[model samples]
Target: MFFAGDIGGTKVNLALCEVHDGRITTQFLRRYSSAQFGSLSDVLVRYVKEIGPLSGKIEGTCFGVPGPVLNGRCHTVNLPWTPDSAEIARDLAQVVEAGPVQLINDLEATAYGIGLLQKSGQGLSILRAATGAIGHRANQALLAPGTGLGEAMLLWDGIRHVISPSEGGHADFGPQDEEQIELLRWLWPRHKHVSWEHVASGPALHRLYRFLKETGRETEPAELAEALAQPGVDASPVIAAMAIRGQYPICVRAFDLWLFFVGAEAGNLALKSLSLGGIFIGGGIIPNVLELFRRPAFFAGLDSKGRMSSVVAGMPVYGIVDPLTALYGAAFSAAHSHGVLHGFR
Candidate 1:
């Protein structure tokens, strides 16, 4: 058995998986609120205790953390806790004596998971071009907008694909039109340097909603307004749901603008990486609001580059529907490190 986790700002998902002949099967899984736990080690300890003793049965462990990993430790970008792989290994040794404990950036894990899915013929249904030809050895990109924006790339290195983590989501936001310029100006006072993540993530939905409301672009319905005013309320999901249902004009517009920025940044990533293999969109938000992304405007923003429009136009794009992408990736990483799986290198 191998242990894997997808640790994020909002929640943490942990699982015990078994790999047989390069295929992974989850033996147990659980989700916990990250805010409720004092640290990742606490959550892992509780999980192991609850799962009963399996001393020396587990081989390796891997975690996909929502931050940059350095020297076996990660200071999470959005969370207050810092988890060290070596510390985790020490803690787990008390119960299972697991082998090498690895920590990787969450987006890197997502890219690896997508590569595994593609190899297994279980990747998201392709958004193919007219010619139905996707570049086999070209680089691939993964961009996810959740609590924060995440970016990663998979480079074809002659024999196999290699996952590389990036903090590109924090790069400066470039406005393409007059309206976006206005939005940038609106955001300028609040943030000295606005990034694509500031305007395109889950929190950005609430930010966009506030901008529209304060500017009197649209009147918020009384019911929705009350819900948003509630203490500790997260308006992002509510706004996205209303937009998808077409219940409010402001919510609809906010969702559209969010997608526009997401598409634009995705296009920018494509150009920067030459990701002809494909662009995979994954996140808690994308899988929920896929309908909004299917609109023509999303594609319009994606292919809006002046001179290089045709290049991106032919590139196939896909939305990852699977929520366990990072979890699977962590498992793959653990198994590969222990020489249990050879499919992913």
Candidate 2:
């Protein structure tokens, strides 16, 4: 059995996978609220207790965290927890004599997961561009927007793709039009350093909703207002649902702007990576509001690069609909580490 996890700020996904002849099958999977746990070890302990003992049956384990990982340790960016692979390995040794416990940046894991999916020809749903257009030796780029935006690149070396993590999500937010300039000015004073993540992530959706209401550009409907005002309520989902139903103009507008920013950042990543292979869009938000991405405004944002418009236009684009990509990646990496899966080195 291989242990794998996708550790994020909002939730933590853990799974036990079985690998046979390079094929991975999940034997057990569970998701826990990250905020409810004090540390990653606590969650792991609970998971091990919940599942029956596997003593010495585990071969290896891998975890993907949303932050920079160095020397098997990482202080997660969005969570109040620090995860160390050495400590985790030692702790799990009591339950199972597991092999090396590996920790990797979440985006790096996602890129690996994408490559694994492409190779297996299973559990991958393509939303755009022609299938199989991404050549085996071509470079690939990944852009995802969740609690925060994530960026990564897969550099193809004759036989395999190398994962490269990026902090490009924190890069400056560039305005494309006068209205965006005004919006930047509005956000500037509140945040001294405005980034694309500030205007494109899940929290950005709430920020946009609040901005429109405060600026008197749009009025929140009574029902939506009440829903947002509820205790412990998250307005992003409600707003997205309203927009999808076309029941609220403000929600629709906010969703549209969100897609525009996302598309622009995706295009920027494509240019920087020269990802003629393809640009894969993956995130919790993309699958929910995918229809909006097909709108003309989104394509306009993606194709708006001044002289490089032609270059980006020819590049294939795709949306990853599978939510378990990170989990799959963590499992694949663990299997590869043990030589159970080949051709990924």
Candidate 3:
């Protein structure tokens, strides 16, 4: 059996699985609120205790962490804790006595999971602003927007497949119009380094609401969230209120601006990597509001890649609807890393 984990801004989930025929057969799994615990180790301890005890020869463990991991150490961006994978290994030595642990950026692991997804007869066609292709099992990217933006790419260089983690989302936020430029100016003072995450994530949504208030727009995220809880409150009600009434012009503007930015960024990613494998968008923000993303404006922004427009236009994009995609991805990465999936080399 092998252990796998998906560590995110809000939660940390762990699972043990038996690998069989390129699939993970779960033995046990659990989730813990990251905020509630003081450190990742706390959750790990709880998980191990709850799962009883391992009885067989455990192979190894792998984790998909939201933050960048350098030299086996990483600090969760939204959580107030730091994790050292090596230290976890030392501690686990006393229990499972398993082998060393491996760590991967959550997005890269997700990208690998995308590669493992069964082909839908699409035969690896690229789709912009959507899920990536399969079969090639290489050269894919994963971009997600949640508490912040996370991105990574996987490359199969013939000899071996490698996963590259990136902080590309932290690159400077570019504007596409006069309105966006004004919004940039509005945002510049508060943040010295304004990245795409500043305008696209959930916290960014709240921040956008605050910006709208400053611009004389009155709606709020809390109010909209309350409305969302109601049976009749769909995205249209909130979107219409913000887009047309300008009741929360800044928030509306932010959302519109984000779609454009997301399109351009995703297009650029497709261009740079030639990820004919596809681009998969996995995160809390986009998947929940598929209707908002399906708007023509969003696609237009993605397809507006100057002379390379056709290249991007043909690229397939998918918003991951499987809530457990990242976890599944983590498991897939673990299996592949441990040499269970066979095609890596």
Candidate 4:
């Protein structure tokens, strides 16, 4: 057996996984509210305790966390606790006998899972097929907008694609139009330095809604306004749910803007990485609003580049509909890294 987790600020996706019938399958899976736990060890202890003796048979475990993982340690912005790989390994190693727990950037885990996902055919839904020359041995890029924007590059090294984590989401926000410029102006006073993540993430959707409502660009719905008024509620999900249901025009507009921002940033990531292999869209946000991602308008700034439009136009685009990708990836990495599993492309 193997253990895996995709730990985010809001929730921790944990699973007891293993290679079964020549494929990785989960024996158990559950999501824990991150705010309820004080640390990762706390969650792990509870997980092992619940699973009982089976936890001792686990071969290894990997955790996918937000932000960069340096020397087996990570400090994330959204979560209250910082996760350390060595510490987690130490705590659970003896009790669960699951070997060392691995920690990796969530994007890296997602990158590792891309191939496994493609193999399964359920994770990636092609939004746009490649129109230009494609390279089988070329690099790829990932753009995920969840609680925050996450980006990564898959570097091809002849035999396998290596995962490289990035904080490019925090890069400066580039406006695409006069309206977007106005939005930037609106955010300038609030954020000292606005980033692509500032306008593209889940929370950013709420901010976009606020920007539109405050600017009088759209009339806020009365029922939606009541929901937003509730304390400590995530307005993003409410906005996304309402917009997807086509129940509120304001929510639709805000979600539309969010898609545009994601598209623009995706284009930027592709250009920076020269990802001729393709671009994979993964995250909590895209799967929920996949219908919006499939629209032509979602690739707006991607091909609007002055001289390199065709180059980008040819790059394939896929949206990961499966939300458990990161968690599965961590499990794969744990088995593969520990040399218990092999033949991973």
lDDT: which candidate is best? 1
Q: What TM-score number comes out for model 4?
A: 0.94
> TM-score: which is higher, 2 or 4?
2
lDDT for each residue of candidate 4 in 1-345, tens digit (9 for 90 to 100): 788999887789899887875468887688889889999999988888876777247778899999788889998977878899889988887567777678999998898788788777677888888766655467899998888899999988878788889999999998878999999999999998999989988899999999999999999978879989999988999898998888888888888888878888888889998898898888887777887886655777566666888778889989988888898889988988888667446
Q: What does candidate 2's lDDT look like per residue over 1-345, in tens digits?
A: 889998888889999988876677786699999999999888988888888866438888999898889889996767898899999988887766767899998988889889877877764555456345566578878998888888999888767888899989999999989878988989999999999999888889888878788888898888888889999988898898898898899998888888788889989998998888888888877777777677876777777899999888877777777788988899998988888888663
Runs off by more than 4 Å, candidate 2 = 130-136
TM-score of 2: 0.95
Error of 3 at 267 (Å): 1.9
The TM-scores, one per candidate, come to 0.95, 0.95, 0.82, 0.94
Assess candidate 3 and give its TM-score to the true structure: 0.82
Better of 1 and 3 by lDDT: 1
Question: lDDT values of the candidates?
Answer: 0.86, 0.84, 0.68, 0.85
Q: In what order do the candidates fall by TM-score, top score first?
A: 1, 2, 4, 3
The model with the greatest TM-score is 1
Model 1, 207-323: lDDT tens per residue? 988888887887888888898999988899999999999999999988888888888888899888888888889987777787688877678878899999998887888888788
Candidate 3 Cα misplacement greater than 4 A, ranges: 119-138, 156-161, 217-254
Q: For model 2, name the residue pairs that clash.
A: none
Error of 1 at 297 (Å): 2.5
Error of 3 at 46 (Å): 0.9
